[model samples]
Target chain A: MPEAEAGTLVLDCDELEELAGALALGAALPQEVAAAQAHLDGCPRSHTDVYELATVARLLAEAPEPVEPPARLRARILATAREDTAPQDAPSGIRYPVSGGGGPVPGTARAPAPARSSLPRRPVFFLLAAAAALAALALGLWNLQLRGELDQRQERLAAQQRFIDAFAGGGRSVAFAPAPGQEALHGAVVRRAQGPALAVFTALPRPAGSDVYQLWAIRGSTPQDLGVFVPDARGHHIATLPDLTGVDAVAVTLERERVPAPTTAPILTAPL
Target chain B: MATGDGPAVSDPDAALLARLVTRDEAALAELYDRHGRAAHALALRVTGNAETAQDVVQEAFLALWRRGHTYQPERGAVRGWLLTVVRNRAIDALRGSGGQVARVLPVDTLVLAATDNPEAEAMQAVDGRRVRAALAALPPEQRDVVELAYFGGLAYPEVAERMGIPLGTVKSRMRLALERLRGSLRAWERDA
Candidate 1:
C-alpha cells in the first residue's frame, strides 16, 4: 500500500552480536547455526570464543591500575556470601549505601536521580517479573477472547516477547504510566544490561500530520535527543536507545518537527 | 580441551565450582580470594565508584553461585566467565549512576596494572603483547566499537547507535576486529 512497506524486514545475517549470541545461546535459525557450524566446524572455535572474548574482555578489567578493593569489602562480600541460602536471590545487603528514594516518578520533570538507579533488588525483581508475567498471561487470555484479529494477536505476542527478552540477561525494564485519563497508552523503557535500552510505546496516538513524537534521554540538566519516530499503523513504537550508560530518565514528547531540543512538556517518561 | 560439552570437574575452577554447587562457603571464599581482586577492580574501573563496584562484584559472585551449575568448561575458562560477569554487572551499575563522570570512556588510556590478577597476570604475561598488538592493529573505529562493547558493555546495536553507524557496519567491524583478536587469543589456551 505504501512505498516504505515494499520491503520485508529481515535479521541481518552477519551481525556479529546476533551471530555470536546465536552460537552461544542457540537462538538462531537452523541454517544460521549450520552456517556458523560449517565455518567453525573446521576448528570448533565458537564456544571457546565466548571464553576467549571473555579473556580479551578481561584485559579491559585488568587494565586501569588495579585498585585492590578495600579489605573490608572482602570481609563484607564474603560474609554476605556465607548467608547459607545457597545464593540468596539478590541479597538485599549487596548494594551498600542504597539510594533511599525510588527516584521521582517519571513524567514529573524532576531532578535526575543517579543514586536512585540500582540493580533490581529481590522484591523489585519479583514485582517487575510478576507484573511482566501477569502482562504476558493477560495477553494470552485476551487473545482467547478476541479469536479473530490475527494481526493484533501477533502484535501482542511480539510485545510480550519483547517484554520477556527485556528481562533476559539480567536486564531490567521500567514501566511507563500515562496520565490517569489515558489508559490506552502503554509503554516501557527496557534497560538491557548487555545492549541498548528500548523505549517501547503502544497505542500511541499518531501525531497530527507532519508532527512526530521524539524520544529524549534526560540526563541531569541536559536532554539528549534520541530520535523521533512515527508508530506503524498498529500504533506501536519501539526505538533503540544508543545506550543508557549514564541516562537518568527517558521521555517522549510531541514535536511538529523534531527539534534539537524539546519544545513541549513530555507526554511520557520512564525513570531509569 | 575437548570440543564436546563434557563436565570439566578436573579443572581447578571446576572443582571450586563443584564445591560452590555443594553450598560450600569455603569454596566461595577460595574463589573470591583468587578472583575477587580482579573482579572488584574490574567493577571499579567500569563503574568508577568503590561502593558500587563492591556491590556489583558481590552480586556477580552470588549470581555465579546460583547459576554455577550452568557453567560449561569447554565453552571457555572459568575466570573468563567470572570477569565477564563482573564486567556486565559493573556496566549495568552505570545506568543512572551518580557523581563525577569519567564523561566518556578514555579508550586510549587503557593501561595494564601491576600484577595481581593471577589469570590476568598469566594471560597478560604471555599473551598480553600479542593480544594488545592485535587490538592495537584494529582500525581506530573498529577498536573503538570493540572496546565500547567489551569494556563499556554496550552491545553491538548500542555500539552502532553510539557511533551513528549502520548495524551492518558495526557488525562487520567487530567481526573483523574479533577475527584478528581470535587469531591471537586462539594460541594462548588454558594450559598455555
Candidate 2:
C-alpha cells in the first residue's frame, strides 16, 4: 500500500472528487494548483490522480467548434416567415357588436325585412358584376405569378443538378460492416472523390447525452479518424470520414475527449 | 485590401445576421462571401458531398433569414448557434439520403492546394483523429457525458434528461470528461 509522507495532508477519495469537480468547472485557480503541487510533492500517490484531473479540466476549456446548420434551412425559415405574414381569416371564436339596421348576427335568427320602395336594383346588380370581374382578374394574375415562381424553382433545381454532375465527380459504391455488436449499422457506402468524402448511415442505439458515434479507419498499424456523427431521435445516423486509402476496416465507437489521453481502450468496435 | 479602411473588424457575422433578419438580399450575398468557405468546408466535412454541402450552405443562410428573430445573443454567440443549426441540418440530410460510411479517401490523398500552408483541411484531419483517440480513452461515464454535450450538442440539462440522470451528475460527468480530454490533448501536443 502507498503510504503518505510525513507533514503532508493525504487526500482520500472525497478530496480527489472535490478537486475533479473544481477542475471541471475551471474554478481551480493557480493557488489551487500550487496547493495541490505542495500536497503532491509530499504524497506521490495523490499527485498523479490530481494532475490527471487538472489536465482534463484544461481541455474542456477549449471545446471544439459548434456544429453548423445547413444553408437551405435559412431560406426555408425565411419562407416560413413570409408565410406567417399572409392574412388568415380563420374564425376568432368571439362575437362582434351588431350595428343599427343590421340583421341578427351570423349565429342568431332574425325577423324578415320589410318591403322597400325606390331602391335601384340595377345599380346594385352592376356593382356585383363588376366586383366578380375584378375577382376573376386577380385570380388569373395570382395563378400566373405562382406558375412563374414554380418554373423558376424547377429551373434552379435543374441548374443545380448540372453543376453537381460537372463538379461533384462521379459517384462510386462502397460497402461497410458494423462493429461486432453493431449489426444494426450495416449499410451501403457512397463514395465521392473531391472534398471530405465518405458517409455511412444506420439505425442503432441512441447514445447517452451529447455522446455521438465516431468512425475510425484501421489499416494495419494506423487508426485514422473519420469524423464524429450523431444519430437522430430514432437512433439513426450518417457518419462521414476524412479521405483515406488502403483502409482495411472501419469501426464506430462511442467516444468522448479526455485529458492526457488515457491508456484505456475503446468500448466498442464495429469491424467493416 | 480597400484603401483607407481602419483595422479589419473581427466577426462581422452579427451584422450579417442582423441584415439577414431584415431580409436584405445584398447582406445575404455578403454573408456568404465572409463565411461561405468555412461553412462549405464544414458542410463538406459533415455530408461528405460537395453538392449537398453547397446546398446546405444556401439553405442554412435562408433559414437564418427566416428565423433570425429566434436568435438570442444571451443563449450563445451567433456563429456557434449558426454552426450548430447547420450541422444538425446536414446530419438530418445524411440520414434522409441514407449516406454511406468508410468510403472516404484520406485528406492526404487529395491533391488540393496547401496554399494556407498548414491548411485547415490537413490540420482538421489530424486533429480529428487525435480528438477521436482522446475521446476513446475516456471512462464510459465521463465519455458519454462529453459526447452528449459536444457532438450531440445537447445542453447540460437536456443531457441529464436524455440520460435519465440528475443534473448534478451530468455536470460533474461533463467536467470530468473535459478535464480528461484536455489532458490527453496536451499530451498529444507535446508528442507532436
Candidate 3:
C-alpha cells in the first residue's frame, strides 16, 4: 500500500484524476486505493479515462522491433495445451486425481463434445442448440441465486418488524431464565399491563425426534397447558401466548406432544 | 485465418480467439505466426534474457489457450488482450528471477476502427521505424521514466528510486509520455 498524498486523508476530484493517470499501469500509490475505486465507481468520465489510459498502457506491451521465438517453444506449448483439454477426473471430492502439469492421465478422455449429438445428424444445428442451452442454464442459475438473496432479505425485514411491534407496545419484558447446563438458551416474555403476552426464544435447543417445547401458564399451584411450538432452523421461535388473566408465571418443558398436564420439569421459567 | 504480420483490415483475430476456445491447435499456430515475434520482443525487453523470454511467451500462449472461453469481446481487441497477457507473464518471471531491465523508450499502438474514413484500415501497423521516431520525439527524461515504469513494471515510487528523482516527477513524466504516445498513434493512423 503506497502512501497517499502526505498530510491529506481525503482526496478530491483533481487528486483522483491525477491518480487515474498512474492507475493505467497500476502504478498509482493508492494507499488511497479504496478512494480511487469509489471515485471511479461514481464518476463515469474518470472511469472511462482510466480505462482508455489503461488501454494505452497496454499498447506499450508490444515490441518496437521484434524477435522470433524458438520454433520448438511453439511446438511444446501447443502440444501441452491440447493435452490440457481433457477434464481432470478427480474421483474423491477431497483430493485431485492427479497433480502437476503433463498430458492427461489414463482413464480420462477429452470430454466428448456436447452430449446433444451421438449420431452426426445436423451437427451444426445440434452444436448451436447445445451452446444456447448452456447459456440459458447459466442465466437461470444466476436468477435463482438472486431470488434466494431476496428471500433472505425479506425474512430479516419481517423479523425486525416483529421486534419493533413488541417494543412499541410498551410492554414489560420478563427474561426466561434457562435451566443450568443449558446457558445457550435465552427467551423473553413480553406482556402489557392488561393484555395478551408474547413468548420469544433464541438459541432454543431443538428438541429430539417427536418432541416439542410445551408452554404452560402457572396460576397459584395449578398449571394450565398452553400449546406446543417448534423452533426454526436457527433455533428461534416466537409466538403469542393465550390470555394472561390472573396468570402469575409461565413455564416451558420438553414433551413428546401436547399433554393435558406437565410430563417433566420445566426447561425454562419466567415470572409475570 | 489470415496469418501475417501486416496491417489488420478486418476482424480475423476474433475468429482465431473463437477457434482457441474450441481447442483448435491450427488456430493457435496461426495466431503465433502473426503475433509471436511481437510477444517475444516484449517479453525479452522486460525479462532481459532470451531463455526467460521464451518461457514467458510460451506460458502466455498456453494461458490464452486455456482461458479463451472467459474472454469477453466487449473488453477490446484480441491482439491487445494477447499482448497484455504476455507483458504480465514476463513481469512475473522478471520479479521471480530478480532480473534488471535497462531503460529505453516504450512504444504502444491501438488502431481504433476509422469511423470517419471507411477507406482507412481497421488497424494500421505503426512499423518499427515510426515507433522509434515517436520515441525519439519525446523529451529524453519523460521517455526514460515511461520506459522504466511501463517496461520495467515498476510503480511510480520505484521508478523515482531508480532514477534518483522525486516520486511526483516520475508520475508526471510517465503521464505525459503515455498521453503523447496515444496522440501519436492516432495521428499516424490519420496519416496512413
Candidate 4:
C-alpha cells in the first residue's frame, strides 16, 4: 500500500477497481485520471495491474479483422497535414473541412499577399522578387507532396507489419498437397487467432489470360473467397485471409478476372 | 514475434517520434495509417457516431503531434496510448452532451501490431479470440458489467445504474470478470 501525499487521496481497493476500469477504457474523468496518476506515482503494483488491464482492452479493440475508412478521410487528413506544414507567414492557403464532405475548406480561398513597400520599387526588381517567391512556394509544395507519398508508403508498411504481427505467434499451421499431376505444388495455411488465415504456396503454375489463384475458406457446403494472388517466378504465392472464422477447410482455385465466385476446382487444400 | 526482453533501442516508434519532434508530417501520417483504424473503432464504439469517431481520431493524432514529448515507450505500446486518447475524447463528447453520436466496430489493423511482446503477438496473431470467447463464456451478468464499464465507458456506478443493479454488485461483477479474464488469458498462454 502507498501513502497519500498532502491534498492527495490514495485509491482503496474499490476505488482501484473503478480506476482500472476507467483506465482500460480511457473513460476516466480528468480528476479521476489525475487521482489515478497520483496514486500510481507511489504504487508499483497498481501500475502493473493497470498496464495488463489496458492490454486486455487493446485486445478487445483489435478483435475485428479491419474496417476500411472512407477514402475522403485520408485526403482530408493529408490536406490538414499540409496546412499545418505551410509557412507560418503565408499559412499554406489551403484547407479541407473536417466534416469529410470532401468540400473545399473555408477561409482558404484568398489572393496572394501584397509585397511589402520596403523592397526596391523598380519593375525588374519586382519581377525578380516575385519569381523568387514563386520558386520558394513551388519548392515547399513539392516537398510536401514528396513527404506525403513517403508517409503513405510508411503507413502501408506499418499496416503490413501489423498483418505479420497478427500471426507472429500463437497461430496454427496446416499443409496442403498437390492433386494428381500437380505433384510439384506444395502449400500451407496458417490459421491465426480467430479469423485471419495466411496461405503460402510454392511451384504454382502461371495462369494464362487474366486468371489468378484465388483462396477460399470452406465451411460445410458453402465456401467463401479469401482473396486472389499470382505466383512469383519461383512459383511462390502468399495471401492473407481477412475473415476465415468458421472455416472447416481451406482451398485455392484458379479464376479469371471479373469472376465473383469460384470458377474452378481447388488445386490445393488444408482441411481444418 | 519480438520479445520485451530485448532492448527497445531500435524501436520504430521511438524513431518515428524523433522525426515527429522535428515537425515531420510524414511521421505523423505514417503513425495514423498504422493505428488510425483501431483508434477510430474505439471512438466509434464509445461515441456511437461515425462523425464523432472521426473527430476523436483526428484529435488524438493531433494531440500526439503536439504532445509527442509526453510519450514514454517503456510505459506501454503506442497503439494503446492512441486508443486511450481516442476513448477519453469520445467519453468527453458523450458526457458533455446527452446525445448519441456514432456506431461502428472493429477494423483492419491492430494498433500494437509491431510491438515486441509475445502476448501482443499472440493476441494479434490469434486476435485474442480465446479471450473474446472467454468473455462470451462468462455468465451474462458478469459479461454485462465488463462490457458496460469497458466498452460502454461507463463508470462502475453508471454501470450499476444502467443495469439496475446495486453498486456493490457492479464492483463484484467487474472483479469477478477481470479475475476470470486473467485466468482465461493465462490459460491460453500456457496452452500456446
Candidate 5:
C-alpha cells in the first residue's frame, strides 16, 4: 500500500530492507512475497538477519498462552485421521468381538483365524465397537462443522473481494488508522456514486457485553447510524451503507443494543 | 529432529512424522496432543475468534497428515514447523485469496538457512519462552511497533500513521528492536 515496487525479482539492499519490513508486517502481497523469496534465495549475506526477524515476528504472533481446543475438535481430528488413513478393506484396527461362529462382525474385520476359535467372546467387545462407531460419527459431524466454517470464510472473502474491486474502478477511498496510542481499530471506506458506500474495518475491539460497534454517517450535529457490526478474526468488519451523498463525516461508536441514537461517545471518527 | 515433551512413547518429532507418513493415526493424535494447544492459541490470536482458529487447526494438521513427507528434519522441530503452517493458514484466512501466495513464506527463511549455521541456530535454539522474554524486554515503543506490525497485521506506512509517528521512525524502531531480539535470542541459544 505504500507504493513499494513489487515487480523487481532481484532486490538490492533497499529492496531487501523493504521486503523485510513487508514480511514482518505480514502485509506482503502475493507478488511481493514471491519477490522477497527470490531475493532471499539469491542473496545469502544478511539473509539470516531477515530470518531472525521473521522468527521473532512469529514468536510474537504466538505470545498468548495456548488455549485448549474443544474436546469434540480433538475427537474429530483423530477420527478424521483414522477414517482417512485406514484402508476400506483393512480392519478398522480397532479389535472387536469375535462372534461364536468366528466370522467378521457387521462393521469391523474379524479376529485372526487361530485366535477366533480359541479366544473367549465377551460382551465388552460389542460395547467398545459401538463406542468406536459413535466416536466416528461425532468426528464426521465435527469435520462438517470445520468445512462449514471454511465455506463461511471463503464466502466472506469473495464478497469483500467483489466489494473492493467494484469500488476500486471508480471511487473515493478513505483509509483509517487508530488515534495516537490506540491500536484496537483501523479500517477503510470506499464510496462510489453508482453503488452503496462500503466500509471494511479490521481489528475493531469487541464492545463489552450486548453492546456493539455501530457505524454512523455524520452530517452537521446529527449522526446517522449506518449499521452495527462485530469483527471476525484479525478484527475485520465490513458493512455496505445505502447512501453517502453529502455525508460530511463517518464515525464508529460503542453503543447498546437497539439504541435509537448515539447513547455514548464515538471510538473512531474521520471527516469525509 | 529432537523430541518435544509429548505423550508419544518414541518422543522425536521425526519419528512421529515417519509414523504419520505410514498413515498411523495414533502418531497424528500424539503430535496434536503435544502441540495442538499452542497451535490453536496462535490461530486464535491471529484470527480473533474460536471458530476460525478451529478451522485453521483442522486444516493445518490435515495438511501435515497428507503431506507429512514434506517435513525435513534438518529444517527444525515439528512443533515449529506446525506452528508456522498454522500461522500462515490463519493469515491466509484473514487476508483471503490475496494472501495465498505460492512462494517462499517468511517462515521459509529459517528452512532456507541450512547452509548458514548462525541463522539456523537462531531459529532452532530459541523456544517460546525465550522469544517471549526477549519481546517482553523490548522498550514499550519498540514493542508496540513490533506487535502492531506483526500481530495487528498492518503495513509499515499504516503502522506509522496509526502510531502517529513518522514512517522513518517506525522502520528504525522495527530494525533496532529486531536487532536486539536477534542478539538476545542468539545469546540465549549460545547459553543453552
Candidate 6:
C-alpha cells in the first residue's frame, strides 16, 4: 500500500475521516481536493485512493439524462387553471353609466317619424300599463332570488375565512370530532390565536401496520419536522407545534416510524 | 427591477408570474413554453420515470404560481431557482411513492457505457470503461456506500440512516472504499 510520507501532508487519519464525511455530503471543499491530490503525488497508496474517489465524483456529476415528461400533463395543468378561474357564486350587479353620451347633442340630426294623429281608446293605455307592471314584478322576483343566493354564499365564505384565520393564528387548543356515520377522525379548533399562533388538532384514523403521524413546519426553501405523535385508542390526538412565525404552512403525514423524520414531501395537509 | 435590452419584456418572469398569481391561464401557458422542457428533464432524472417526472413538473409549476412572490432574484438566476424547485419536487415524489428507494444506476454505468460507443471522440482520451470496471470489482458494501454518496446525492447522515449503520462506520467504509478503487483504477490505466 502506498502510504503518505512523513512530511507530504499534515493530515492524520481523523482528518481524512472528516474529509470523507464532507465528500459524502457533497459539500467537499475544492481546496481540500487539491491538497489531497498534492499529497497523493508523493505517496503511491494515497495517489490511487484519491484518483479513484475523483473518478467516482466525476461520474456522479454526469449522471444519465432524466426521463422526458409526457404530453398529457399539460392538459391536466391547463384544466386546473380553468377550474381556478371559474366564477364564484356571487350575484351580478348592474351599475349606472357615469357620463359619456353628452345629453342629446343639440346639433345632431334627428329623423322625424310619420305622425299618428289617431288617439286610440283609453283602455289600451291601461292594458299596456298592466303589462309593464307584471314585467316589473317578475324582474323584482329575479333580483330577490339572486340576492338570497349571494347572502348565503357570503355567510359560508365568512365562516370559512374565520376557520382559516383561526388556523393561521395557531389556535390555542384543538379537538377532534368524529365524522358522521364514519369511524375516521375529524378535527376542530377549540381556541383561536390572537395573531398567528393558533393551535389546531385533527383526529386521524388509527394507522394500520407500523405507521405514525409526523408534523412539519414548511417555510421558504425547506421543511422542518415538528415531531411525531401517536393517536389514542379513539383515533383522536393533538400535537402542539412551535411558533408559526415566518412559516408559510403546516402539514401532517402518515409515515413509517422507522423513517424517524418526516420526508421532504407531505402526504396530507390541512388547508389554512 | 428592469434589465435593458436582454428580452423585450421588462421583468418578464415577474410580470408573467404576477399574472399567474391571479390564475391567468395565458400567462401560465407562456411560462410552460419558456421552461417546461428543462424542468421536465430535471424531474425525470431525479424521479427516474416519465410519468412521475411529468407530475413533478406540473406540480412544480403550480407551486410556482401559488408561491412566486416568495422568490428572491438575489439568490440566483430564475432558471436555477426553477431547476432547484423541480429537483426538490421530484425528490419529494420519490419519497412519497413509499419507502422503497428509487433505482438510480451508479454514475460508472454511464461512463463505462459511453466508452463502448465507437463513434465517440472523447473516449479516445480517457478509458472510462476500465475505471468503471475497477469500481465494479470492489466489495458490494463499499461500492454501495460510494455510489449512494456520490450518485444518489445523499448526505452522510442520510446514507447512514438508509444503510442502518453508524455514521463512523460509514465514513471508515468510504475511506477504505475510495482507497481501493483508486488503486485499482491506477493499476488498470498503467497496464493499458
lDDT of each: 0.53, 0.44, 0.59, 0.54, 0.58, 0.46
lDDT of 4 at B184: 79
lDDT of 6 by residue, A63-156 (tens): 3332334567777877765554222111112111100010110111111111233543234468678778798778988899989987976675
Task: Give the alpha carbon lDDT tens digit for every residue of B37-94 in model 4.
Answer: 6677667877788888787777777656655654546435556456556655666566
**How does candidate 4 fare on TM-score?**
0.47
**Candidate numbers sorted by lDDT from highest down:** 3, 5, 4, 1, 6, 2
lDDT (10s digit) by residue, model 1, range B115-168:
323443345333234545667777798788776765665655667789999876
lDDT of 3 by residue, A1-272 (tens): 23334322345677765755465664654234334544544555634444555555655654356777788978888877766643222211111111001111111211212123244333456788888879877898889998998787667646644663574377677777655434346677877566667887765657656467778776553455577888988777887888776777787766544543343446677878
- Could you give me the TM-score of model 1 versus the true structure? 0.43
- In model 4, what lDDT does residue B86 have? 67
Q: Fraction of true inter-chain Cα contacts (below 8 Å) kept per model?
A: 0.15, 0.05, 0.30, 0.11, 0.28, 0.14
How much lDDT does candidate 3 score?
0.59
Ten-residue region with minimum lDDT total, candidate 1 chain A: A93-102
Of models 1 and 3, which has the larger DockQ?
3
lDDT of 6 by residue, B1-192 (tens): 122111121236667776754556777777776667657765666677888878777776765554454444432234434554565456557656454422221212111122223322121223334545666887998878876665454556667889999877777777777667556645654666
Candidate 6 at residue A269, lDDT? 42
Candidate 3 docks at the CAPRI level of incorrect
Tens digits of lDDT, candidate 4, A143-193: 999899878766754554454444535776677644433434566777766
Clash totals for all models, in order?
0, 59, 0, 12, 2, 10
| Candidate 4 positional error at B81, Å | 0.8
lDDT of 5 by residue, B22-119 (tens): 66777888888778887888888878989988988887787667656545455445666677677666765665543122222334432233324555
Each model's DockQ score:
0.13, 0.04, 0.15, 0.07, 0.17, 0.10
Clash tally for model 1: 0
Instruction: List chain A TM-scores, every candidate, in order.
Output: 0.39, 0.31, 0.38, 0.36, 0.37, 0.34
Minimal lDDT window, size 10, model 1 chain B: B105-114
TM-score of each: 0.43, 0.29, 0.53, 0.47, 0.52, 0.38
Q: Model 4, residue A236: displacement in angstroms?
A: 72
The prediction achieving the highest TM-score against the true structure is 3
Comparing candidate 5 with candidate 6, which one achieves the higher TM-score?
Answer: 5
TM-score, predicted candidate 2 vs. hidden true structure? 0.29
Which 10 consecutive residues of model 5 chain A have the lowest summed lDDT?
A: A96-105
Output the worst ten-in-a-row residue range by lDDT, candidate 3 chain B: B102-111
